[model samples]
Target: MNIPGELYFTKEHEWVRIEGDTGIVGITDYAQHSLGDVTFVELPKIGADVKQFQSLATIESVKAASDIFSPVSGKVAEANKKIEDDPALVNRSCYSEGWIAKIKMCEPSEKNNLMDAAAYKKFVERLEH
Candidate 1:
């Protein structure tokens, strides 16, 4: 619901914030709402390599567990350790502190394939109908 203007989105419901050759990834607000109250998360370790549209992490909520997809191909540079300690942060702050991983983007051009906020906004609108 709160799709920030600066981020890109994937059909899998992941959001990406790009900065230079790095990207911060996380599930969108719509994803957290659909999942209900989050209980746990399995984040990929640093140095892990991830491919576009592939599984990068897993999130468990009261409703269900889901695999979080990578919006771009990259190597994991860092993960939000705080979320492992308190998964609720995802429900509370999905855009900022709740970001799951920071990747050293392997192909910066891949971002062009991802949906911009406006496009993603339209995509979610289509889903609601």
Candidate 2:
């Protein structure tokens, strides 16, 4: 799976790319693969207040539907409405155009609760065995 080194991760299989005080969030490559072809995404609402590890979104796939958790607390600054129209973007490019939301961080320090890519890499590996 493609786990970008710059991002932080949650055990729930989400990732967050920190940019300034904003965090762009999404599910990891491993997550998309496990879910099979994605059919829909319930994008978070803009201006919504979300807490760390809370249900930030819901994704439906050929295999199952799952709740995607936030990696940090914040207000939803933006939601990727593009995914609402074409959910396949999530399967095609989970790291970039597929990001779910951009959150205006309430506690940047909450990032510490998440795993670095290397640690998440090891975490996924452990799951494989």
CA lDDT scores, all candidates in order: 0.94, 0.95
For all the candidates, what are their Cα RMSDs to the real structure? 0.6, 0.6
Model 2 spans with C-alpha error above 4 angstroms: none
RMSD of 1: 0.6
Name the runs in model 1 displaced over 4 angstroms.
none
Per-model TM against the reference: 0.98, 0.98
- Decoy 1 TM-score against native: 0.98
lDDT of 1 by residue, 1-129 (tens): 799999999998999999999999999999998899999999998999999999999999987889999999999999999999999999999999889999999898898989999999999999999
- lDDT by residue for model 2 (1-129), tens: 799999999999999999999999999999999999999999888999999999999999987889999999989999999999999999999999999999999898898899999999999999999
Residue 12, model 2, lDDT: 92
lDDT of 2 at 28: 95
**Model 1: worst 10 consecutive residues (lDDT sum):** 104-113
